[model samples]
Target: MEKLLGEFSIGLFFWQTVLFLALLFLLRKFAWKPILNAVNDREEGIKNALDSAEQAKREMENLQADNQKLLKEARAEREEMLKEAREIKNKMIDDAKEEAREEAGKLIAQAQASIQTEKKAAIAELKSQVANLSIEIAEKVVREELSNKDKQVKLVESMLGEATLN
Candidate 1:
Protein backbone atom coordinates (compact mmCIF):
# COMPACT_ATOMS: atom_id res chain seq x y z
CA MET A 1 0.00 0.00 0.00
CA GLU A 2 2.94 2.31 0.80
CA LYS A 3 4.66 1.71 -2.57
CA LEU A 4 1.40 2.19 -4.48
CA LEU A 5 0.78 5.53 -2.87
CA GLY A 6 4.38 6.52 -3.44
CA GLU A 7 4.06 5.74 -7.20
CA PHE A 8 1.59 8.65 -7.67
CA SER A 9 3.89 11.60 -8.49
CA ILE A 10 4.21 14.86 -10.48
CA GLY A 11 6.05 13.13 -13.38
CA LEU A 12 3.13 10.77 -13.99
CA PHE A 13 0.69 13.66 -13.73
CA PHE A 14 2.66 15.71 -16.28
CA TRP A 15 2.85 12.78 -18.75
CA GLN A 16 -0.91 12.12 -18.44
CA THR A 17 -1.71 15.77 -19.10
CA VAL A 18 0.48 15.75 -22.22
CA LEU A 19 -1.18 12.55 -23.52
CA PHE A 20 -4.74 13.95 -22.97
CA LEU A 21 -3.92 17.17 -24.86
CA ALA A 22 -2.43 15.24 -27.82
CA LEU A 23 -5.48 12.93 -28.07
CA LEU A 24 -7.81 15.96 -27.99
CA PHE A 25 -5.84 17.64 -30.81
CA LEU A 26 -5.88 14.49 -32.97
CA LEU A 27 -9.63 14.03 -32.48
CA ARG A 28 -10.36 17.68 -33.30
CA LYS A 29 -8.26 17.48 -36.48
CA PHE A 30 -9.59 14.15 -37.78
CA ALA A 31 -13.07 13.47 -36.42
CA TRP A 32 -14.82 16.76 -35.42
CA LYS A 33 -14.95 18.35 -38.91
CA PRO A 34 -16.31 15.14 -40.54
CA ILE A 35 -19.00 14.71 -37.89
CA LEU A 36 -20.22 18.34 -38.20
CA ASN A 37 -20.24 18.09 -42.01
CA ALA A 38 -22.31 14.87 -41.84
CA VAL A 39 -24.88 16.56 -39.53
CA ASN A 40 -25.18 19.60 -41.86
CA ASP A 41 -25.64 17.36 -44.90
CA ARG A 42 -28.39 15.42 -43.15
CA GLU A 43 -30.18 18.67 -42.27
CA GLU A 44 -29.94 19.91 -45.85
CA GLY A 45 -31.31 16.58 -47.20
CA ILE A 46 -34.28 16.76 -44.84
CA LYS A 47 -35.05 20.34 -45.93
CA ASN A 48 -34.91 19.40 -49.60
CA ALA A 49 -37.21 16.43 -49.03
CA LEU A 50 -39.78 18.64 -47.29
CA ASP A 51 -39.68 21.16 -50.14
CA SER A 52 -40.15 18.43 -52.73
CA ALA A 53 -43.19 17.11 -50.83
CA GLU A 54 -44.76 20.59 -50.81
CA GLN A 55 -44.18 21.02 -54.52
CA ALA A 56 -45.73 17.65 -55.27
CA LYS A 57 -48.78 18.56 -53.17
CA ARG A 58 -49.27 21.77 -55.15
CA GLU A 59 -49.01 19.92 -58.45
CA MET A 60 -51.63 17.45 -57.30
CA GLU A 61 -54.05 20.24 -56.48
CA ASN A 62 -53.56 21.80 -59.91
CA LEU A 63 -54.19 18.46 -61.59
CA GLN A 64 -57.40 18.04 -59.64
CA ALA A 65 -58.63 21.48 -60.74
CA ASP A 66 -57.85 20.72 -64.37
CA ASN A 67 -59.76 17.46 -64.15
CA GLN A 68 -62.82 19.22 -62.75
CA LYS A 69 -62.73 21.77 -65.58
CA LEU A 70 -62.48 19.07 -68.19
CA LEU A 71 -65.41 17.22 -66.67
CA LYS A 72 -67.59 20.33 -66.82
CA GLU A 73 -66.69 20.93 -70.46
CA ALA A 74 -67.53 17.35 -71.35
CA ARG A 75 -70.92 17.62 -69.66
CA ALA A 76 -71.71 20.82 -71.52
CA GLU A 77 -70.73 19.30 -74.84
CA ARG A 78 -72.93 16.30 -74.18
CA GLU A 79 -75.91 18.49 -73.40
CA GLU A 80 -75.41 20.45 -76.61
CA MET A 81 -75.30 17.24 -78.61
CA LEU A 82 -78.53 16.07 -77.04
CA LYS A 83 -80.23 19.36 -77.89
CA GLU A 84 -79.05 19.16 -81.49
CA ALA A 85 -80.34 15.63 -81.82
CA ARG A 86 -83.75 16.67 -80.54
CA GLU A 87 -83.89 19.54 -83.01
CA ILE A 88 -82.99 17.26 -85.88
CA LYS A 89 -85.67 14.80 -84.84
CA ASN A 90 -88.28 17.55 -84.76
CA LYS A 91 -87.26 18.79 -88.18
CA MET A 92 -87.52 15.31 -89.64
CA ILE A 93 -90.98 14.87 -88.19
CA ASP A 94 -92.08 18.20 -89.62
CA ASP A 95 -90.73 17.26 -93.02
CA ALA A 96 -92.62 14.00 -92.93
CA LYS A 97 -95.87 15.74 -92.06
CA GLU A 98 -95.41 18.27 -94.85
CA GLU A 99 -94.74 15.54 -97.36
CA ALA A 100 -97.86 13.70 -96.29
CA ARG A 101 -99.98 16.81 -96.70
CA GLU A 102 -98.59 17.48 -100.17
CA GLU A 103 -99.26 13.90 -101.26
CA ALA A 104 -102.86 14.13 -100.00
CA GLY A 105 -103.39 17.39 -101.86
CA LYS A 106 -102.12 15.84 -105.10
CA LEU A 107 -104.41 12.84 -104.69
CA ILE A 108 -107.46 15.07 -104.10
CA ALA A 109 -106.69 17.17 -107.16
CA GLN A 110 -106.35 14.08 -109.32
CA ALA A 111 -109.68 12.71 -108.07
CA GLN A 112 -111.47 15.99 -108.79
CA ALA A 113 -110.01 16.18 -112.29
CA SER A 114 -111.10 12.61 -113.05
CA ILE A 115 -114.68 13.36 -111.86
CA GLN A 116 -114.87 16.50 -114.05
CA THR A 117 -113.68 14.58 -117.12
CA GLU A 118 -116.30 11.86 -116.59
CA LYS A 119 -119.10 14.40 -116.19
CA LYS A 120 -118.17 16.13 -119.43
CA ALA A 121 -118.11 12.82 -121.30
CA ALA A 122 -121.60 11.95 -119.97
CA ILE A 123 -123.03 15.32 -121.10
CA ALA A 124 -121.56 14.95 -124.56
CA GLU A 125 -123.10 11.47 -124.94
CA LEU A 126 -126.55 12.74 -123.89
CA LYS A 127 -126.36 15.55 -126.49
CA SER A 128 -125.49 13.09 -129.25
CA GLN A 129 -128.38 10.82 -128.29
CA VAL A 130 -130.87 13.74 -128.37
CA ALA A 131 -129.64 14.78 -131.84
CA ASN A 132 -130.04 11.20 -133.18
CA LEU A 133 -133.62 10.97 -131.79
CA SER A 134 -134.59 14.28 -133.38
CA ILE A 135 -133.26 13.19 -136.77
CA GLU A 136 -135.23 9.90 -136.63
CA ILE A 137 -138.51 11.65 -135.76
CA ALA A 138 -138.09 14.15 -138.59
CA GLU A 139 -137.42 11.35 -141.12
CA LYS A 140 -140.54 9.45 -140.02
CA VAL A 141 -142.74 12.59 -140.33
CA VAL A 142 -141.41 13.28 -143.81
CA ARG A 143 -142.08 9.71 -144.92
CA GLU A 144 -145.69 9.79 -143.66
CA GLU A 145 -146.42 13.16 -145.30
CA LEU A 146 -145.03 11.98 -148.65
CA SER A 147 -147.01 8.74 -148.62
CA ASN A 148 -150.04 10.60 -150.17
CA LYS A 149 -149.31 11.54 -153.84
CA ASP A 150 -151.95 14.41 -154.02
CA LYS A 151 -150.62 16.02 -150.82
CA GLN A 152 -147.00 15.72 -152.16
CA VAL A 153 -148.04 17.48 -155.45
CA LYS A 154 -149.77 20.29 -153.54
CA LEU A 155 -146.70 20.62 -151.23
CA VAL A 156 -144.41 20.81 -154.29
CA GLU A 157 -146.53 23.60 -155.96
CA SER A 158 -146.55 25.62 -152.71
CA MET A 159 -142.82 25.17 -152.32
CA LEU A 160 -142.25 26.36 -155.96
CA GLY A 161 -144.48 29.42 -155.46
CA GLU A 162 -142.61 30.33 -152.22
CA ALA A 163 -139.29 29.92 -154.08
CA THR A 164 -140.48 32.30 -156.93
CA LEU A 165 -141.58 34.94 -154.41
CA ASN A 166 -138.13 34.67 -152.60
Candidate 2:
Protein backbone atom coordinates (compact mmCIF):
# COMPACT_ATOMS: atom_id res chain seq x y z
CA MET A 1 0.00 0.00 0.00
CA GLU A 2 2.81 2.40 0.76
CA LYS A 3 4.63 1.54 -2.49
CA LEU A 4 1.39 2.04 -4.53
CA LEU A 5 0.84 5.44 -2.93
CA GLY A 6 4.50 6.34 -3.46
CA GLU A 7 4.30 5.38 -7.15
CA PHE A 8 1.11 7.47 -7.73
CA SER A 9 2.23 10.37 -9.93
CA ILE A 10 0.15 13.50 -10.84
CA GLY A 11 1.45 13.54 -14.46
CA LEU A 12 0.47 9.90 -15.02
CA PHE A 13 -2.90 10.48 -13.34
CA PHE A 14 -3.56 13.57 -15.52
CA TRP A 15 -2.72 11.65 -18.74
CA GLN A 16 -4.99 8.71 -17.69
CA THR A 17 -7.85 11.09 -16.99
CA VAL A 18 -7.46 12.70 -20.44
CA LEU A 19 -7.36 9.32 -22.21
CA PHE A 20 -10.50 8.10 -20.28
CA LEU A 21 -12.40 11.29 -21.21
CA ALA A 22 -11.43 10.84 -24.91
CA LEU A 23 -12.55 7.23 -24.92
CA LEU A 24 -15.90 8.16 -23.29
CA PHE A 25 -16.43 10.88 -25.92
CA LEU A 26 -15.70 8.43 -28.78
CA LEU A 27 -18.00 5.74 -27.28
CA ARG A 28 -20.86 8.23 -26.77
CA LYS A 29 -20.51 9.45 -30.37
CA PHE A 30 -20.18 6.05 -32.09
CA ALA A 31 -21.70 3.29 -29.90
CA TRP A 32 -24.24 4.97 -27.53
CA LYS A 33 -25.97 6.99 -30.28
CA PRO A 34 -26.54 3.94 -32.51
CA ILE A 35 -27.62 1.73 -29.57
CA LEU A 36 -30.18 4.31 -28.34
CA ASN A 37 -31.53 4.77 -31.87
CA ALA A 38 -31.91 0.97 -32.28
CA VAL A 39 -33.76 0.73 -28.92
CA ASN A 40 -36.13 3.57 -29.90
CA ASP A 41 -36.82 1.92 -33.28
CA ARG A 42 -37.54 -1.44 -31.60
CA GLU A 43 -39.99 0.24 -29.20
CA GLU A 44 -41.84 1.94 -32.08
CA GLY A 45 -42.11 -1.38 -33.99
CA ILE A 46 -43.55 -3.17 -30.94
CA LYS A 47 -46.10 -0.39 -30.43
CA ASN A 48 -47.16 -0.57 -34.10
CA ALA A 49 -47.55 -4.37 -33.85
CA LEU A 50 -49.75 -4.05 -30.72
CA ASP A 51 -51.96 -1.42 -32.42
CA SER A 52 -52.42 -3.67 -35.49
CA ALA A 53 -53.35 -6.63 -33.25
CA GLU A 54 -55.94 -4.52 -31.44
CA GLN A 55 -57.49 -3.38 -34.75
CA ALA A 56 -57.60 -6.95 -36.02
CA LYS A 57 -59.39 -8.07 -32.82
CA ARG A 58 -62.03 -5.34 -33.27
CA GLU A 59 -62.57 -6.37 -36.88
CA MET A 60 -62.92 -10.03 -35.89
CA GLU A 61 -65.57 -9.13 -33.30
CA ASN A 62 -67.52 -7.14 -35.89
CA LEU A 63 -67.38 -10.03 -38.34
CA GLN A 64 -68.64 -12.46 -35.68
CA ALA A 65 -71.58 -10.19 -34.94
CA ASP A 66 -72.44 -9.95 -38.62
CA ASN A 67 -72.33 -13.75 -38.98
CA GLN A 68 -74.63 -14.18 -35.99
CA LYS A 69 -77.09 -11.69 -37.45
CA LEU A 70 -77.07 -13.49 -40.78
CA LEU A 71 -77.67 -16.85 -39.07
CA LYS A 72 -80.66 -15.50 -37.20
CA GLU A 73 -82.13 -14.05 -40.35
CA ALA A 74 -81.69 -17.37 -42.16
CA ARG A 75 -83.46 -19.25 -39.36
CA ALA A 76 -86.37 -16.82 -39.46
CA GLU A 77 -86.65 -17.18 -43.22
CA ARG A 78 -86.63 -20.96 -42.98
CA GLU A 79 -89.41 -20.94 -40.42
CA GLU A 80 -91.46 -18.60 -42.56
CA MET A 81 -91.04 -20.81 -45.60
CA LEU A 82 -92.06 -23.90 -43.63
CA LYS A 83 -95.14 -22.16 -42.34
CA GLU A 84 -96.13 -21.13 -45.84
CA ALA A 85 -95.62 -24.62 -47.18
CA ARG A 86 -97.80 -26.10 -44.47
CA GLU A 87 -100.53 -23.59 -45.19
CA ILE A 88 -100.40 -24.42 -48.88
CA LYS A 89 -100.60 -28.13 -48.15
CA ASN A 90 -103.63 -27.68 -45.91
CA LYS A 91 -105.34 -25.54 -48.50
CA MET A 92 -104.75 -28.14 -51.19
CA ILE A 93 -106.23 -30.85 -48.98
CA ASP A 94 -109.28 -28.75 -48.26
CA ASP A 95 -109.78 -28.07 -51.95
CA ALA A 96 -109.52 -31.74 -52.78
CA LYS A 97 -112.10 -32.64 -50.15
CA GLU A 98 -114.49 -30.02 -51.46
CA GLU A 99 -114.12 -31.31 -55.01
CA ALA A 100 -114.72 -34.86 -53.87
CA ARG A 101 -117.88 -33.81 -52.08
CA GLU A 102 -119.17 -32.06 -55.20
CA GLU A 103 -118.46 -35.06 -57.39
CA ALA A 104 -120.28 -37.38 -54.95
CA GLY A 105 -123.28 -35.09 -54.88
CA LYS A 106 -123.47 -35.11 -58.67
CA LEU A 107 -123.27 -38.89 -58.83
CA ILE A 108 -125.99 -39.30 -56.22
CA ALA A 109 -128.29 -36.93 -58.06
CA GLN A 110 -127.84 -38.83 -61.31
CA ALA A 111 -128.58 -42.17 -59.63
CA GLN A 112 -131.75 -40.84 -58.00
CA ALA A 113 -133.02 -39.48 -61.34
CA SER A 114 -132.36 -42.80 -63.07
CA ILE A 115 -134.25 -44.67 -60.32
CA GLN A 116 -137.28 -42.38 -60.60
CA THR A 117 -137.45 -42.88 -64.40
CA GLU A 118 -137.25 -46.66 -64.06
CA LYS A 119 -140.02 -46.71 -61.43
CA LYS A 120 -142.41 -44.78 -63.68
CA ALA A 121 -141.75 -47.10 -66.60
CA ALA A 122 -142.37 -50.19 -64.42
CA ILE A 123 -145.72 -48.81 -63.14
CA ALA A 124 -146.90 -48.11 -66.72
CA GLU A 125 -146.05 -51.64 -67.88
CA LEU A 126 -147.95 -53.18 -64.93
CA LYS A 127 -151.06 -51.11 -65.72
CA SER A 128 -151.03 -52.20 -69.37
CA GLN A 129 -150.72 -55.90 -68.41
CA VAL A 130 -153.64 -55.68 -65.94
CA ALA A 131 -155.91 -53.97 -68.53
CA ASN A 132 -155.18 -56.65 -71.18
CA LEU A 133 -155.95 -59.45 -68.66
CA SER A 134 -159.24 -57.87 -67.65
CA ILE A 135 -160.36 -57.55 -71.30
CA GLU A 136 -159.52 -61.20 -72.03
CA ILE A 137 -161.44 -62.41 -68.90
CA ALA A 138 -164.53 -60.40 -69.86
CA GLU A 139 -164.49 -61.82 -73.43
CA LYS A 140 -164.34 -65.39 -72.11
CA VAL A 141 -167.26 -64.81 -69.74
CA VAL A 142 -169.39 -63.35 -72.61
CA ARG A 143 -168.69 -66.31 -74.92
CA GLU A 144 -169.67 -68.84 -72.16
CA GLU A 145 -172.93 -67.10 -71.40
CA LEU A 146 -173.89 -66.88 -75.08
CA SER A 147 -173.28 -70.67 -75.45
CA ASN A 148 -176.18 -71.19 -72.99
CA LYS A 149 -179.13 -69.82 -74.91
CA ASP A 150 -181.60 -70.00 -72.02
CA LYS A 151 -179.29 -68.12 -69.66
CA GLN A 152 -178.46 -65.53 -72.27
CA VAL A 153 -182.15 -64.97 -73.01
CA LYS A 154 -182.95 -64.56 -69.28
CA LEU A 155 -180.12 -62.12 -68.87
CA VAL A 156 -181.40 -60.07 -71.77
CA GLU A 157 -185.01 -60.11 -70.45
CA SER A 158 -183.89 -58.85 -67.01
CA MET A 159 -181.78 -56.06 -68.56
CA LEU A 160 -184.88 -55.01 -70.62
CA GLY A 161 -187.16 -55.01 -67.60
CA GLU A 162 -184.79 -52.86 -65.51
CA ALA A 163 -184.40 -50.42 -68.34
CA THR A 164 -188.22 -49.99 -68.78
CA LEU A 165 -188.78 -49.37 -65.05
CA ASN A 166 -186.08 -46.66 -64.90
Candidate 3:
Protein backbone atom coordinates (compact mmCIF):
# COMPACT_ATOMS: atom_id res chain seq x y z
CA MET A 1 0.00 0.00 0.00
CA GLU A 2 2.88 2.56 0.58
CA LYS A 3 4.29 1.88 -2.86
CA LEU A 4 0.89 2.57 -4.51
CA LEU A 5 0.52 5.89 -2.63
CA GLY A 6 3.96 7.07 -3.73
CA GLU A 7 3.14 6.26 -7.37
CA PHE A 8 -0.19 8.13 -7.09
CA SER A 9 1.58 11.24 -5.64
CA ILE A 10 3.82 11.38 -8.75
CA GLY A 11 0.72 11.38 -11.03
CA LEU A 12 -0.85 14.18 -8.97
CA PHE A 13 2.28 16.31 -9.22
CA PHE A 14 2.30 15.86 -13.02
CA TRP A 15 -1.37 16.97 -13.32
CA GLN A 16 -0.77 20.04 -11.12
CA THR A 17 2.20 21.18 -13.22
CA VAL A 18 0.14 20.82 -16.43
CA LEU A 19 -2.78 22.82 -14.97
CA PHE A 20 -0.53 25.62 -13.72
CA LEU A 21 1.20 25.95 -17.11
CA ALA A 22 -2.21 26.05 -18.87
CA LEU A 23 -3.53 28.75 -16.51
CA LEU A 24 -0.44 30.93 -17.03
CA PHE A 25 -0.82 30.62 -20.81
CA LEU A 26 -4.53 31.56 -20.70
CA LEU A 27 -3.91 34.69 -18.52
CA ARG A 28 -1.09 35.90 -20.80
CA LYS A 29 -3.30 35.47 -23.88
CA PHE A 30 -6.55 37.18 -22.57
CA ALA A 31 -6.11 39.14 -19.33
CA TRP A 32 -2.45 40.22 -19.31
CA LYS A 33 -2.42 41.29 -22.99
CA PRO A 34 -5.54 43.46 -22.66
CA ILE A 35 -4.38 45.02 -19.39
CA LEU A 36 -0.98 45.97 -20.81
CA ASN A 37 -2.61 47.52 -23.91
CA ALA A 38 -4.99 49.54 -21.72
CA VAL A 39 -2.13 50.82 -19.56
CA ASN A 40 -0.11 51.85 -22.64
CA ASP A 41 -3.10 53.73 -24.11
CA ARG A 42 -3.63 55.60 -20.84
CA GLU A 43 0.10 56.54 -20.75
CA GLU A 44 -0.14 57.88 -24.29
CA GLY A 45 -3.23 59.92 -23.38
CA ILE A 46 -1.45 61.47 -20.39
CA LYS A 47 1.60 62.34 -22.47
CA ASN A 48 -0.56 64.03 -25.14
CA ALA A 49 -2.42 66.04 -22.48
CA LEU A 50 0.83 67.24 -20.93
CA ASP A 51 2.12 68.23 -24.35
CA SER A 52 -1.09 70.24 -25.03
CA ALA A 53 -0.82 71.97 -21.67
CA GLU A 54 2.77 72.98 -22.40
CA GLN A 55 1.75 74.32 -25.80
CA ALA A 56 -1.07 76.34 -24.21
CA LYS A 57 1.31 77.81 -21.66
CA ARG A 58 3.72 78.89 -24.41
CA GLU A 59 0.90 80.48 -26.41
CA MET A 60 -0.29 82.38 -23.34
CA GLU A 61 3.22 83.72 -22.78
CA ASN A 62 3.42 84.85 -26.39
CA LEU A 63 0.07 86.61 -26.09
CA GLN A 64 1.22 88.38 -22.96
CA ALA A 65 4.38 89.54 -24.70
CA ASP A 66 2.34 90.85 -27.59
CA ASN A 67 0.06 92.74 -25.22
CA GLN A 68 3.03 94.30 -23.48
CA LYS A 69 4.46 95.45 -26.78
CA LEU A 70 1.15 96.96 -27.81
CA LEU A 71 0.87 98.75 -24.50
CA LYS A 72 4.31 100.28 -24.92
CA GLU A 73 3.45 101.44 -28.41
CA ALA A 74 0.20 102.98 -27.20
CA ARG A 75 1.97 104.84 -24.43
CA ALA A 76 4.53 106.17 -26.88
CA GLU A 77 1.78 107.31 -29.23
CA ARG A 78 0.00 109.09 -26.38
CA GLU A 79 3.18 110.83 -25.38
CA GLU A 80 3.79 111.92 -28.94
CA MET A 81 0.29 113.30 -29.23
CA LEU A 82 0.66 115.18 -25.99
CA LYS A 83 3.95 116.61 -27.12
CA GLU A 84 2.38 117.79 -30.37
CA ALA A 85 -0.51 119.38 -28.52
CA ARG A 86 1.83 121.25 -26.23
CA GLU A 87 3.85 122.48 -29.16
CA ILE A 88 0.75 123.69 -30.92
CA LYS A 89 -0.41 125.47 -27.81
CA ASN A 90 2.88 127.21 -27.44
CA LYS A 91 2.93 128.21 -31.07
CA MET A 92 -0.58 129.60 -30.84
CA ILE A 93 0.29 131.64 -27.77
CA ASP A 94 3.38 133.05 -29.44
CA ASP A 95 1.44 133.95 -32.53
CA ALA A 96 -1.26 135.66 -30.51
CA LYS A 97 1.30 137.69 -28.59
CA GLU A 98 3.03 138.74 -31.77
CA GLU A 99 -0.23 139.80 -33.34
CA ALA A 100 -1.14 141.81 -30.27
CA ARG A 101 2.18 143.62 -30.33
CA GLU A 102 1.77 144.46 -34.00
CA GLU A 103 -1.74 145.72 -33.45
CA ALA A 104 -0.60 147.93 -30.59
CA GLY A 105 2.20 149.38 -32.69
CA LYS A 106 -0.21 150.22 -35.48
CA LEU A 107 -2.57 151.89 -33.08
CA ILE A 108 0.23 154.03 -31.67
CA ALA A 109 1.32 155.03 -35.13
CA GLN A 110 -2.20 155.98 -36.18
CA ALA A 111 -2.66 158.03 -33.02
CA GLN A 112 0.58 159.93 -33.62
CA ALA A 113 -0.43 160.71 -37.22
CA SER A 114 -3.83 161.90 -36.10
CA ILE A 115 -2.21 164.16 -33.50
CA GLN A 116 0.16 165.64 -36.06
CA THR A 117 -2.69 166.36 -38.46
CA GLU A 118 -4.68 168.05 -35.72
CA LYS A 119 -1.69 170.17 -34.71
CA LYS A 120 -1.16 171.31 -38.26
CA ALA A 121 -4.84 172.19 -38.67
CA ALA A 122 -4.79 174.21 -35.42
CA ILE A 123 -1.69 176.18 -36.53
CA ALA A 124 -3.31 177.00 -39.87
CA GLU A 125 -6.43 178.22 -38.09
CA LEU A 126 -4.33 180.41 -35.80
CA LYS A 127 -2.48 181.94 -38.75
CA SER A 128 -5.76 182.68 -40.58
CA GLN A 129 -7.18 184.39 -37.47
CA VAL A 130 -4.05 186.50 -37.06
CA ALA A 131 -4.20 187.58 -40.71
CA ASN A 132 -7.88 188.55 -40.42
CA LEU A 133 -7.18 190.53 -37.20
CA SER A 134 -4.29 192.36 -38.86
CA ILE A 135 -6.44 193.27 -41.84
CA GLU A 136 -9.20 194.59 -39.56
CA ILE A 137 -6.69 196.67 -37.58
CA ALA A 138 -5.20 198.21 -40.77
CA GLU A 139 -8.67 198.98 -42.15
CA LYS A 140 -9.64 200.75 -38.88
CA VAL A 141 -6.40 202.84 -38.91
CA VAL A 142 -6.96 203.86 -42.55
CA ARG A 143 -10.59 204.84 -41.81
CA GLU A 144 -9.47 206.99 -38.89
CA GLU A 145 -6.78 208.64 -41.00
CA LEU A 146 -9.20 209.25 -43.86
CA SER A 147 -11.82 210.80 -41.52
CA ASN A 148 -9.72 214.03 -41.69
CA LYS A 149 -10.49 215.62 -45.08
CA ASP A 150 -7.34 217.83 -45.10
CA LYS A 151 -5.02 214.82 -44.43
CA GLN A 152 -6.84 212.77 -47.07
CA VAL A 153 -6.38 215.49 -49.70
CA LYS A 154 -2.71 215.80 -48.83
CA LEU A 155 -2.29 212.00 -49.07
CA VAL A 156 -4.05 212.02 -52.46
CA GLU A 157 -1.79 214.77 -53.82
CA SER A 158 1.32 212.88 -52.68
CA MET A 159 0.07 209.71 -54.37
CA LEU A 160 -0.64 211.75 -57.64
CA GLY A 161 2.86 213.32 -57.52
CA GLU A 162 4.54 209.91 -57.20
CA ALA A 163 2.50 208.52 -60.11
CA THR A 164 3.56 211.42 -62.46
CA LEU A 165 7.30 210.85 -61.65
CA ASN A 166 7.09 207.25 -62.97
lDDT of 1 at 121: 90
Pairs of residues at least 3 apart in sequence or in different chains that clash in candidate 2: none
Q: Quote the RMSD, in angstroms, for model 2.
A: 7.8
Using TM-score as the measure, what is the rank order of every candidate, best first?
3, 2, 1
Worst 10 residues of 1 by lDDT: 134-143
lDDT of 3 by residue, 30-140 (tens): 999999999999999999999999999999999999999999999999999999999999999999999999999999999999999999999999989987996698578
Q: All candidates' TM-scores?
A: 0.59, 0.63, 0.65
Write down the lDDT of every candidate, Cα atoms only.
0.90, 0.92, 0.92
Weakest 10 consecutive residues, lDDT, candidate 3? 134-143
Per-residue CA lDDT of model 2 for 1-166, tens digit only, reads: 9999999999999999999999999999999999999999999999999999999999999999999999999999999999999999999999999999999999999999999899888888888888788668746776888799998888678868977995
Question: What is the alpha-carbon lDDT of model 1 when measured against the actual structure?
Answer: 0.90
lDDT of 3 at 120: 95
lDDT of 2 at 30: 99
Stretches off by above 4 angstroms in model 1 are 1-32, 127-166
